[model samples]
Target: MSDAQYTLPKTNSGPWNTRPFHRQWLMRQANNLFDFFEAASLNPKGGFFELDDAGKPLDGANSTRQIHGTTRMVHCAAIGSLIGRPGSGEILDHGMQYIWNQHRDTRRGGYVWSLDNGGVKDGSKQAYGHAFVLLAASSAKLVGHPLADQMLADVTEVINTRFWDASRGAVKDEYTSDWSKLLPYRGQNANMHMTEALMAAFEATGNKDYLTKAEAIAKLIIAEHAASLGYRVAEHFDENWVLDKNYLGNEMFRPAGTTPGHWLEWARLLIQLWVLGEKRLHWLTDAARHLFRAAIDLGWDKVHGGFFYTLDWDNKPVMREKLWWPLAEGIGAASFLTSYDRDDYFQIWYRKLWDFADNHMIDHARGGWLSELKEDLTPTSRLFVGKPDIYHALQACLIPLYPANGSLTKGIIEADHTAKIAH
Candidate 1:
């Protein structure tokens, strides 16, 4: 194809022209998600409520809130608010207050794990939730939230002092309520999120320390850990940050085998890191390409269309169920690779993944994307109930439209600003 033919048309009306059509589709999806989740999810008492089968917010005893879920809403709302969405600022404020009043441990330093209508449900301090806290604060800062800076500073201190293990080059998993004792188990899952949060922190605060930490984590997880394990990131780990390939922990987060979703996520993040780090580390691009191929080779369902949730050590599908977020990450990773390399395969993968999401994961009648589905593309709530979080899906839509900046928050802001000037 010629250069002009190689480029997609800028017109919005098209079938699968990635340049304009995909970006426009993403904007519509993101706007729809913000509108739906904001209207259908706001809790009467506090943080956003999880929706039920019928898409209504769950109430009473079913209204139990997780810290990660609450923080994800905050992060998404912050992004919406920054992009000029109406009513998102209120949700951002509400989420920040919920984190401060309900989730934070006054006696201790870190945030709690979960909460109910009554009070604290799980008092454990998890690195996963803390990572979201960092992400939420970073995005909130972009929207000029009053408490964002304080929350960012507080969470940064907690992550660095309590969770980060400088010697191991990875963060620890969890801690007790009083922050007295650290958990023996370690996890790259939490660390992966931490890497994401740290990159956002670098963008929000302009702190080189945060960027340095993020680079270290990317090195440890991708280059050191996954490189040795056939580019399949090891989820569970011991106190020394050694991969425990045999560890069978939480079926959802820390599964026994590898999650294809995470490989895609890491690939996208590595690309961002490569660009953000001034392309100093040439190997990050190679690692990202390798990781994306690993995910495609092992996690993709050949018979079916969607990506599998997990794969066993021998590359067999451990969990055949297809979650919405993996496809989201796949779209993002494919977009990033195609943007940088101009690889036709990545573009094809990007179009195919978006088509899969539109066919199955996206809710045509309802506003937001469906959370999970079975192998037959039937909606299933086995692993996830309702739309637990919009972070992944929202990013999937937005990330493709922007360049691979240090973080999504920064990219979105810059893209919005540039669009406004063009208009």
Candidate 2:
């Protein structure tokens, strides 16, 4: 595919003109996900890995060296469900094996954050990691995995013991192996992720408490972190929910401003809650709509095809580079929006996503998607290739469910092409 051939379609002024093409596009995207899962499952590690150009495993030198344990678990569960594969069960079992034998803090209740190549605990306990554990466990249950019940119980016990802050009525961010809360109670990213994970857990187990917590967090976003003027979710906060303006060495929540990525992620969870018929359906819907509109107004790049990485509350661009994750999130939010009655806005985002994926992120010379891109639509990083990791690939897999023109399938092809290029 030549760059000249990759023009982004205009935002729909009225309804979308090509409805049938969109359905076919989604079907093809679903097929691509099936193909991705099939290839990823053949590895002996029983989990996915990031592959180099020669399809060799990336070196495992430190904490960042190995495929993230939580990422592997979520991806395995998602792809497994998408393709109707029993191996997803095996993958979930493999993750549980690591948690039980390697990372389980018996003195505490939750699992450790990272494990070394030998499967020994290598890091402290983190709420973010535990959220993925819940997500994987819940997904396993949805797909008829036999051990799902036991996994659910184990994770539930962990959540109850370590992360749950009973006095505060909210989950804490991280802790020592003995269940001591880390100072500062930072990491809004963990809260955002847990909100999403809780949505999945509520679906899997019919747990009203999980749904209630998820709703509470959504309410928290509106009450505590939301900027009164623009409705953007604030990036960082202390235990009492005081806004922390200082950068303060927290790499996880950086750029010190409102971000499209986090908003998009939050929108995803809110939509999930909306679909699940949570009592606060109208509130959830309004929150998602507000975030979606803010994300587009602030982060979208008009000259280029995709969104900027992050933006401040004033709608000024912060990190102009287009990170891989936001694009995935954008596609997800746009796809979800397409299911609603707002067809014009949906087509705009849908076309923008396709154009961005085609021009910048897609590796036409190779296969699969690139990790990141410059604001000018240039490749900036390469992390994962065909070797499966859940986040981006899962987003790609979900694109087909939304109504779109053939552009969405073309986006899938670009993802495959990027993977091929990396290999």
Candidate that scores best on lDDT: 1
Clashes of 1: 0
Candidate 1, residues 1-423, lDDT tens digits: the string is 531135444462232335576568789999878877886777878887887645688664458889988899999888887777899888889999999889998877889999988899999999999999999898888888999999999999999889888987778898889888888898888988998898888888889899899899988888998999989988887887777878988877787888989999999999998888889999999999999988887888777778888888899987889998899999889878887875556776777798899898888887678888888778898988777777888988887777566566788788778888999
TM-score of candidate 1 versus the correct structure, residues matched by position = 0.94
Error of 1 at 186 (Å): 0.9
Backbone clash total for model 2 is 14
Output the TM-score of candidate 2: 0.80
Off by over 4 Å in 1: 1-18, 59-62, 419-423
Candidate 1 weakest ten by summed lDDT? 8-17
Worst lDDT 10-window in candidate 2? 402-411
Native-vs-model 1 lDDT?
Answer: 0.84
Most accurate candidate by TM-score: 1
Q: Candidate 2 residues 1-423, lDDT tens each?
A: 323234334653433333667656544554554444435433354344455433444544332322244444544554455444545555555654554555556655667666555554545677777777777667666656665677678877777776777555567776775665475666567777777777777766778888778777666765456636466777777877677765444433356666787777676667666666533467776777778777776677867757776665567786677776777777777666665535456556666676667677654454455666677876654322333344554555455453322222223334556668999
Return the TM-score for each candidate structure: 0.94, 0.80
